[model samples]
Target: MAETLATYEVPEHHVKMYTANVQAALNKEGGILTPLVSSNAYTGEKSQVVNFIGEVEFVERSTPYGDTKVTELEHTQVWISGREYDCAVFIDRLDTLKMIYDPTNPYVERFREAAARKMDEIIMSKFFADRKVGKDGTSTSAFGSANTVVHGNTGLTVAKLRSLRKLIKKRHVKVRTVRPKIAVTAEDVDNLLGEVAVTSADYAAIKPLVDGEVSSFMGFDFIPYEDNGGTSGDGKSIPSFQDSGSVVRQLPVWVPDGMHFGQWDGLTIKISDRADKNHIKQIHGTFTAGATRLEEGKVFQVQSKNAA
Candidate 1:
């Protein structure tokens, strides 16, 4: 009798384990922006709409009941179109049996990280991108320049932070009520730590230099983002432009409610045998998601140097 080898077929228990692992990775490592913004879940459609209502004026009733004042409710909408994203890897049965350790875990981690990066990239692009608005979502509105803080041939600094805070204050946004957030690269943090004001005890309570990170300061929560995966069209992750022969980085600064993320299908995984490819085991992960800037007034751009 000839010896038989155990088949490397995917079992039901293994499928659940892989799915749980990928989901855990996404929640821990990949979801930096998902929880920081407005989120909505939809089904049976590829598009979702977020509605906003304008403030109504409250006029004093001098005559007590003079012809009952009437005001129409103003409504506007932002439409989010979900796009599918997926990643997959196949393992040959012979190779799986030959390997000392399983390779599925690494593939799951890769898929989780790629999906997470894509989500943040979408949110970052929406900060300055034109937004679809109006009743039918057929109108496009550009991000207002008044909300932008110019680079001035410098990196992230206290002065720029003050200017960014001032811009939001001028819009009458209550800083105490709605905490603002700013996403910065590692270079930006280094620039801040290099500043005398940030390191000096007279200006800051915590020593940023010793801490090696800026958790929060200047009435803005700092989000450390190193991934520079470029946006659509130009392929520059953090929007940048040439200024005086210097490449300036456009960092996004916005409130939580200013951006929206829509999900038609959450992160999902599938493990199956590919019959067309010699019965190789395939591990695949996918999701359908979209993000959009809810309003220009609540979102701003801070232009800084690409390098300190």
Candidate 2:
């Protein structure tokens, strides 16, 4: 005897449940860098312009009541345009009937994971890319080369961390105020573990080898992030590159304020039956967002060999 077929209809409550699930998943796994950067929501705007005021020199008073020295404040801006990202999946009515369980949950997980990775990719791309500056945001400013720590044909080590810290400190960025963070891959963490100073109990209180991760060292929070050689809109892997016959991973060390994420629309989901396509259920998720480097001094890159 054949199994009795019954009509399936998506409940309104089910749609709300799925939407909440997607939003929660995105917030939880939407990349390590997204939560660490400056994020803002916008309405009716294609792009966001962040204004920066340059440092002003304080003139010492030479006379008791001398004329005030007239000075102009330097103004620059960084423009971040929103980009749309989405994922869709369809489930045939027959497929749903044959399956023992609903497949929508698995598809939702995949979408959230991919979207999370994409968010990180956007941030990593902007770390070293040129920024749109000037009052009208028409001019372009290259990332300061002086801020980069050369690979030196080696993987990440304490020496590089110290050098990176020194460079940031030279810019007068206080650790408490700036809250510096460094994005590193598993290979980079392994290299650090191999070093005596990092793993050895004598040098540090926290043994990275025992913990199986580098939580924090040298006043910088170490965040494990895999680049996967992903490219941005400009078709460049700003996070890693080939140099000196070696694949160099461009790890970014930055303060939260140095990078920005503008969200035109937060993660949203829609599920409905496609009437024209034999009533197949469609799961669609999308978000409009963009990222940009806010300041050159607040962001720095550490280039290290990607090696075993």
Candidate 3:
């Protein structure tokens, strides 16, 4: 006996609730490169150009008063574009109405978690591809193979931070006025600052180090982000930046709104019941977002191990 199927339209408020839940979960993860990049809300899926102030030279004064040479303010442009991400989850017809009433439904939480993870992967994979560190640690040009390491066996240290500061300065990136941030993975944190020699004087001097809390170091805020284990646009697993790894990729030191760009239409949600033969209802979340390293010099990547 075939059962009669009917279309069920999810209420507006219910859709809003799901959107809010997913957005909240996404925000909680915090951003490594996103916060430090230029972003804009765009409507269409066309190519957009993002501008940045470029290096300019001072004009020399002439003895004879001639027309002041008109020098155009220097600027550079990077085309910002993004791809769409859509995730759909099926909910049993029996509990569809129950979901609208109960915000604490397990299915809702599961969907939120899944969406947030995918969002992280999309952004981080772009970061890994666009803002790569080359074999020569001193090269301040573009992304290349992960061949440079920050600290040898010592991992991240105060000295390494100072070196990073120097490299940023050399790149002509101004860090004296606005301090840049250093983003490290959970693995890097453990290898770098998690351990302390109880008998050492350095351990006794700093209470946070002794207590295992490292919030800020060397004038830069430390952000701990777990590396993504998911696949990237190329269908390859996202690489790790841990010590003794084959591909030595790790955290990057970035100036806020300096090197990266994000083109976004934001995230929109839609509900449909006619699809899937009405036997299974669906909730879909769609987002059009993309990220790029607008300035190679502004983002610096360091390896977990020493370049041998």
Judged by lDDT, which candidate is best? 2
Global local distance difference test of model 2: 0.74
Candidates arranged by lDDT, highest first: 2, 1, 3
Candidate 3's displacement at residue 147, Å, is 12
206-273 per-residue lDDT for model 1 (tens digits): 24424445467777888776645454323226677777677687888888888888877577878776
List runs of model 1 lying over 4 Å from the truth.
1-7, 28-30, 70-73, 92-108, 197-199, 202-214, 229-236, 306-308
Runs in model 3 deviating more than 4 A are: 1-7, 16-33, 55-64, 70-75, 93-116, 128-141, 144-154, 194-214, 231-247, 261-263, 274-278, 306-308
Model 3, TM vs. native:
0.72
Estimated TM-score for each candidate: 0.83, 0.81, 0.72
- Alpha-carbon lDDT of model 3: 0.57
- In candidate 1, list every pair of residues with a backbone clash: 230-236, 230-237
The residue-by-residue lDDT of candidate 3 on 146-232, one tens digit each, is 323354555566567677777777778776677776656555555554444443654443335324344655667665555344433
Alpha carbon deviation, residue 140, candidate 3 (Å): 16
Best by TM-score: 1
**Cα lDDT of model 2 by residue, 5-96, tens digit:** 23465666666676677667787667767889998887677766864566788888899999999667766778887889888777654444
Worst 10 residues of 3 by lDDT: 132-141
